[model samples]
Target: MAGDRALLRQALSTGEETDGRVEFKERLSREVHLSEARFESLAAQLRHRVLSGDGEATYVVGVTDEGHVAGIKPDAFSESMDVLNLIADEAGAHLDAVETWGTKDGIVGVATVKDGGTLEIATDHLIVGTAGHVDHGKSTLVGSLVTGRPDDGEGGMRSYLDVKPHEIERGLSADLSYGVYGFDDAGPVRVDKPDRKSDRATVVESADRVVSFVDTVGHEPWLSTTIRGLLGQKLDYGLLTVAADDGPTETTREHLGVLLATDLPTIVAITKTDLVSAAETDAVQRDVERLLRQAGRSPLSIARHGTDAALDEIGDGVVPIVRTSAITMDGLSTLDTLFEQLPKTAAAGGEFRMYIDRTYRITGVGPVASGTIESGTVAAGDSLLVGPVQEGTFEEAEVRSIEMHYHRVDRAEAGRIVGIALKGIEETDLERGMALVPKSADPTPTRRFKAEVMVLNHPTRIHTGYEPVVHLETVSEAARFEPLDGQLLPGDSGETEIEFKFNPYLIEPGQQFVFREGQSKGVGTVTQCIE
Candidate 1:
């Protein structure tokens, strides 16, 4: 990642030759080179590179003799990797990881051959998404927690995450905004003006353990945005807020259903407890318990049983309830402790994938794609395919740089939200609902897929010709749903074929989706795909 790059490089040096730790091979011969001296010679060079790197080396396949990136055939590249694998093994090393992307007519990849053995990168940070009714103090509670400052009860602290002018005037968040703080070896590390990009970046870099809040809107009209937060982002847990004075609203229950439907571990936070008497707070807790039980989930009291038990039971169909007051900062530390100790349930593995949630152009950096890495790791200089344009195709692009929050970083792993500055694409081409994937992934966009769908709520029944907008990852589009059988009523699970009414998207089997139309809502899983 340092200095110049050749697909992958721990550090490339100045001049025609590299730092001796990086190697470029168009293709490695699979002939009897292993038993011959040719293998020993190549293995000896790899060993020297490892020694030079202190037991780490980088190998770039499909490079031309002209020093250009002319990708090789897939078979040749595989053989090259096989040969490199043998060399690494002979040199007392292993191919720890490989990152692949599309080239002009073929594909290129970087193999991180290492001798130190694989180390597990723990997801020290937990991303908690907030959901509730408007004016339940979702934003204000997050603002106070991130700044370590108690709200003045006049809703002054809401500015920490709420950005839009209209949202400020209306005292409600209208879209998704993120605020993060961290815990270090000492304790919690709070920052000022966390709404700013730079401050949030500082938190991610400085803290040993970090917690991010995806503050979502609670208004009925902005329900799509809330669903986007719950469905699009790689969220670890859900925080549903219910004011003690007004326990749970219709919107609160709807949000809870969607959160639990996504199978995200949820925690109910009784907010504004100071506004009501102790008895009233107790009544709100009971109401929350009833709602959880109605939803077929158990409730655990953090105050009664403690944070350790809440963490243990929250994943096992248990919804932990915590009481909080932005006015007094009550119960903030309990949530903080729980967050600090919570292991990131999300992980980074498999093929590198990211969905573009936001896009922007830097003053001189051109277009950048921002989103959380959904599956695998990505590095600067990695080639990726982005899009499923109206034509249902993808365009090749190269990652020029990577940045987390606002601080420029060399690489990013899964579950880490980042903005990737790109080359070979215009800013106008990037949009939400699009995705970034490795070229070798060979992902295809599909218009029709058979899914196992269940109607959560509906007026009558779902028959052929029923249309609902399906929210798959970041791709949201209306699709025609035809029951494979006769018809489906509420709570009826059946096979259905869905054809995108508009643009085709990069979707596959086993992916989950949430669809909604008017008063009808449901959750489904793609069982099979058809182009």
Candidate 2:
């Protein structure tokens, strides 16, 4: 039964039998027994056996000589594909080495299941985040850091496609909103002011790094995207902005929901400080401390505020807050000083990684993928394996072009939002969960994942093997999360070692995902993959 060439060849080489035709000859006996019915059954059995991990090594030597016939019904191509699909699955889950060959003589198959290799280590932080409630002055703080001003003019209405403040305010149709600034490794310590006092913006560049200070939508509905953007890259320190005058609100609380989840270090910026009196500033500081305590942070916890007392309180890991009137140009230096003190990103480019947080096709160019460089360096023509695992399958992809910002370049370093033109990948293949990786890493496609999730809203119950939309980077997909542990209730922080039925894509560990309710509709990240 095992020596059956027809069945063995079909499953191994082409993954399907040749349309009800089983040709064979008996060399030694001079009489061939062609059992077509037997061949059909044998072929199915052979495919099942190979997928079931039965034989160590099998080969179809040749046909015997005498031709014979036995009647048997054949299956459709789709049905045969199902069998091959099973084989591909088994190969991914277990087998390390396998090959199949078909020749005029017959078919041949070879397989050796060996131990898998370790994934590539990331040299830089994969993702970072910034959060403050709606109108919490998140945009103002980002503007102050990048443009050296407090008022970005239109506030949250800045345009993503156009970098100019005026153009952005005019509602320019662009995919992203953020100003890109490149700096040298030496650092930009000096802070200047923008000409338009109304805009209150200044930009200074130094060396080795580029900061595109992004002012994203801080509203609750956009919170998922805000978190998604922050989760897409590893950060130096997460900056949380709060207006001294507005204090804490419900929206601010929602911002805190995402902040407290990750282990990343954070800075608290008290904007609109000049709007209130000195005593009121101190009181606002106190209120911030109280809010921090309520959110599980200690009041005595050192947060960056603009004052010697606040700085002293922060000690080495200080939370120095600066009081800045984007109008008066005061405290701009303090902001610069804070940025200078920011910890550099972990190492530099090591492993090749980029999470596509945003992507679009330029008017002339075809398809482009954009996201912060998670790790390693990417140059033009360098092959990048990009895709995500959804519903327990790995969808493969490749990048055609890689660029920094809008400029056409051969390659880009980690820690920047790169726009890449993917070759051979259509718009369908590119999604938010997808991550670019080096060719060395053996990609694993899985649908089940074990993770630790802190429920943001109440009534939190993610059912076992329940399918939800997983949002990571710029990719989103319908994925099922099967809990290895029991049900997780709201505010109940526990570990669920569940199987992730991800879409057919490859996702690495340490990537952040937000879960939503439906296909390409929800948000979430996979915290762990248990195999």
Candidate 3:
């Protein structure tokens, strides 16, 4: 009975959270009236409560367009069976009984319950809030939320789990860190403690329903790190935090520009808001908004509170404004609510592949590929296909174990950064853009691919078939571009028939990629292998 409700809500919701209060108002009707009598009946029978937590209960309601109640909506039909199974299996016969009826002009379905049940459901709503800017207190905000104290340590802050060759060359040091956190309507979701002051990393717990945050370093050299933070994962939304008192600096503007260009559902956090009074905060907020508008966004929502109010606003779909002060512990709670407010993490369960961001061989460990698990899971002892080395060679490797944060785990899924130990593979066999996947399902490999390339940051416009360095699957190599059509100007998209002078095999078709000029880079995806 309990499991039934969890499945119902999980299936129907487009990755959002309820206030935990099961109040039903007819969507088609204008007046916000609660059907207390029906709700009580559903609530009394314990049919609606799927998974109940401490101070949290998620309810599922099926209704029609005409302000009536139906047992379950038509679209929710197939999944409701799972809910019924759960109801029968976990809650017993009495609790398993579900009531279906028609009301007014439409039909409504209700599941009500009051009880204790532990059901692990995958998240429909997941978001990543990147903490950028050097020593900009990115880790401090993480510490305050996780440890309930200000973060004062430094070094070994892992910002991204990537599989790009350059990213691998950037290397993982004490300074590279990945932090994930989960939050809900009330407050911070429980997170494991960071290993040490310097190794501050957080993992958004699996049980988390709505929001997950990824904190990154704000140092200058980590621009690629920042790009990895953004491009490494397909995010539903982004939270860009800038210190209010410091004003808009150059790096701040550059990062801000990139985020805006991505058109990601974005929210801006003006940190240190507590340092300024109401008036000062307002002034800074205006300045930030102006800068953002200059970047082509309408004024975004700004929050200046020590409470979770900002987070609530974020959860409620307010954009552009969030204020937090780790120093005063103000607005710390808002971070979660703000995170919850964004759109849900897209269902990314298709291909189980990742670009290798970093690779190294410990004297005894063999070859280790450290990167975020982009789409699928990698398990211990699973044969991994490592491929498309710049030299066009493919190699088979074995996954010894997977690590999330610093803790070893048997497997890792999409949305988490993980490290895998590869046996029978050498460091030279891998590059930053190389990909790793399960051995059974092979990847199509080709050195030359037909793709659509856009020239961004190039010294001049790129004509069709021009030569450029191709960055794909963690490796970057020189390739000849045979444009499918005309010249590609900056910011314009064009299809090209590209053929490498020498074919580098091991990459598949349909893989998205980036092209790097001496210092500038543009984005593209593999369409067809030229052969």
User: Considering every candidate listed, which one attains the maximal TM-score?
Assistant: 1
TM-score of each: 0.77, 0.61, 0.60
Model 1 lDDT, full chain set: 0.81
| Predicted candidate 3, C-alpha RMSD | 18.2
Off by over 4 Å in 2: 1-129, 149-176, 182-209, 298-320, 347-350, 388-400, 460-485, 497-505, 509-531
lDDT at position 231, candidate 1? 81
Give candidate 1 regions above 4 Å deviation.
Answer: 1-123
Error of 2 at 506 (Å): 2.9
Least accurate 10 contiguous residues by lDDT in model 2: 25-34
Clashes of 3: 66
> Compared with the true structure, what per-residue lDDT tens digits does model 3 show for residues 422-495?
76777777767677877887677665567765565666677755676664544546677666656777777888
Q: Per-prediction RMSD in angstroms?
A: 10.1, 19.4, 18.2
Model 2 / residue 217 / CA error / Å: 1.8
Cα-based lDDT for every prediction: 0.81, 0.48, 0.54
170-272 per-residue lDDT for model 1 (tens digits): 8888888888889888999888888666577567767888787889999899888898888888988999999999998889988998898888898889999
